[model samples]
Target chain A: MSRTTVVAALAAGVLLVAGCSSDEPAPAPSSSGGAATADAGQDHDYTVEGFASSVLGDGTLDDLEDVGSASGEIEGGQVEAQIVSVVADAAGTELVVVLRGDDTGSPSRWSESRGVFTDVRGVEVVDEAAGWRLQPYTILDVSGESDLGCACSEFPYRLGEDGTVVQALLPPLTEGTTSVTVALPGLEPVPGVAVTWR
Target chain B: MQTRPRRTPRWPVALLAAAALTLPTAPAHAAAAPEPGSTVDVAGVDVPVHGTFSLRAAGNASRDLVRGAVHGVRRVEGGTAVYLSLGLPASASRSLPLSSIFTRSRDYESSALAAVTLVDRPGMTAYVPLRGGDAAPYSSDVSEFRALKPGELVVLWAVFPELPAGTRTVDVLVGDARAAVTGVPVEDGALEPVADDLVPQAGEGWPKIAEGDALAGAEAPWSVRPLVQHRGSVDEVTDVAETAEEVDATLAADVLFDKSSATLTAASQDAIARLAADIAARGTGEVRVVGHTDSDGSDSSNQTLSEQRAAAVVAALQPASGTAVTFVAEGRGESEPVAPNTSPENMQLNRRVTVSYQVQEATR
Candidate 1:
């Protein structure tokens, strides 16, 4: 029960899978598993390595703890993240994770520089029991470009003073599941986040 | 996966939690947000407050009807086409934030007000439109939706990946609100292909559901083709998604270049050669090589690096992919990403070189 594994592959030009783990194994990474594999012919360039993994976090949903609203902060150097709320809609699990800075100075000192906070895809929804991670839901324009500015906090993001609130909308967590986890990028996973309904 | 019966009988909040109901822990459901409209339930999904989405109810299933609409959806080869006809009741003068209402894709909250959703109850999965169904400003490039007067209906449709096999009924939600609609059966047969004109607009008057065909020519042709990645085996550097005609291959930037440099790494050459050979066998003629980067550096620098990397890929693949194939290189900075730049694993996907080409032989 201690060393449960959830392996997510980083397929070069092919996948956007997260290296997320929980108490169970991960579901299939992509939608269809019928595409030509590395051994199907073009075996030269297929690589599942050179990952950009979390420097501070290991991206694991440790022990299935149902400690509703564990106030323990997911510390990320200058900035800290806390699960504000978990609102359940029909298919959308809208989570508000407030991020703030402990040591205020220039924004450069913060762990989540500009790169991570700017794009809304930073947050992902992990269904621990199902052992699959859902990508952030994004509203797309005609040309297939996503407009996720409303979903999360915008950057140059004042991670100081009041700190910014990052609202990530993801697919609904599995039914009957009581609690889940939330990890803000470089920060560790905040376990036992309650799934509240309206 | 066991299909639990629909949660139609929702007892009091505290009791329901103690009992066998599958609803979320809504300790705040009865407490915080309470609106005007009475409680309406669809396949166990509680439309929190039915007041906001004041539309008419159809039959026992309570299909949310705005005057009338195409009953079910057109199940196409690529996906399903949902043509909805929405209208406000005569007395209720409501301003529909068109974008907010239908913008609810599989995993997005378009706005705070309401987001549309389609639930495959049996499959226990929710699906948003793969494309289309967005309101005027975004979907049509027309005008932003003005406040819709009563008796006026908006005919909007979107394309979604084909429903899970054996799935018949789907629940439609506009911000947790599904007036009477949910449990709509999947229409029989394939979606009729017409001149794509499923324009999202508030029409002059209400549309009668005289026949349940594809909204009397309210179908959308795929501008964005159905793209699927085959991932049975583990492949690190090259990831590919293919349409019947085009194959889009994404190669890892880490393996291909040094930090901020476009110069192809010596090790990546072998990989490129393999990819080139694959393309040469399948490609008909033209190949577009586009470069992308993760959001780590400044936007300007990322753009420059992406462009340079694309050119390098083109140089590497042009000769190898056959003389008949022409390679063109383009750069999309940190704009379009397959994954969020949150973790290193996600960021690695953003930094890649994508080479797309037409497939001469149809390969699924």
Candidate 2:
């Protein structure tokens, strides 16, 4: 098959289809099923949203991957980040993913001139057919101030359907939680990256 | 793993090809370059030699390979000449190659001499080869040994190429330095060969063995006790066991006195003090002191001089008195010797006394 289809197929194969296919028609107008339907419908209303934050790339997450460029979204108090470049520490215990903003109104680049933040507790890993699945929590640590300290210890996170972290080692965050941040040794205007949660 | 019987080294296909054709025979010869280092073999390694080594047995050797070298080795067959190569630095002696013996003018003629001495057998030869599988016959003559200078290293290899061979040991002596190597005979000759049996690899075990210790966790009896327990005192056994309570304190010392003199030398003082301490520690034991002399003087004078030496020691011990003492002095002049009578040290052992303790019985 084509490379695009293969990559997509690999990604989909990891979803782990567990339920059997149904053949019978749905029942009409069941009074007892109404309450359950309402709850199920409410769970689907989850709109990709999260708080915006950045962290040091000191192994606060597992299963971190590199995206093409750093452009992400912040929705529903949750940050959805698309990280491009990744930097691993000398000891292989921490990883840093460069974050960027890709919304039509603004484009972002991997630079040190800007601020980046993320929640240290959001990193998780999930093992799926498509290698490992990484799920991060909401960007709960974004303080808006540009002086986010050194990028020596924060990292960007990759999200999965089920919040599971996949990186081998994660460093404790400033608040004694897991977090990571990626920095290009001497670059300014550090790009803006966001995080999303399940 | 199944152990297959040892056999001759599997010669390369090319070597076997050469072996098939009959070659001319000649007396064994060494190569142009002699072994240049100490020779040693690891234990249980099977080494073999054919080709040139084989030709030596046929009595048609072309050139002498081990020209001038000292050797110490044991060979499988009889009649091989064994020689020890000397005159080189210890290191070079061990490495002098057997091949160094061949003369250029002679075009490497095989010499019948063995490097080390061995009992003569009609057609037996020991062919030694390097780890790289080169063989040279042992040489037998002191003149053939290559002279060694300072700071040279030589490695000599002992060749043993036969099957059903027992473990053979050889001490390779290079001047004063020595090393050892063992050889295992591999095979008789290349005939019907058995393949080695394959065994399970390490880390993989049968489940039965993994179960381990059929009687593990079986009941066992064990006990522990404190260092001291307060039990009522039991009856004592006759206060103390009947044993020797006294020790000998009188010791005879002989000092090399100036001719016909009674004066004791400074060396005699320490020996006399040790005797005094022993006597002071003995509760009330009698001391019998004796002395002897070397066969250097007339019998009567030696005896008199010995008595005087014993008296000197007694005089020194009398000052340290903690026990009653009885001094019985005797002299034996050159009557008995402990070592060779020729050395001064042997004479010293002869001129001494042994003390014995005589504890008196309790007075009823």
| Each prediction's whole-model lDDT (CA) | 0.44, 0.27
By summed lDDT, the worst window of 10 consecutive residues in model 1 chain B runs over B26-35
Q: Local error of candidate 1 at B344, Å?
A: 17
List of chain B TM-scores, one per candidate? 0.40, 0.30
Among incorrect, acceptable, medium and high, the docking class of model 1 is: incorrect
For each candidate, report its DockQ versus the true two-chain complex: 0.03, 0.00
**Candidate 2 C-alpha lDDT tens digits along B114-224:** 121111011111122111111322222223434323222122222222211332322121110011111111222221111121111111110011001221321111100
* Candidate 2 Cα errors over 4 Å, as ranges: A1-198, B1-260, B358-364
lDDT of 1 by residue, B154-237 (tens): 454444556766777664443222322344556544322222333332212112211223222223332222322221102256
Q: Among all windows of ten consecutive residues in candidate 2 chain A, which has the lowest summed lDDT?
A: A45-54
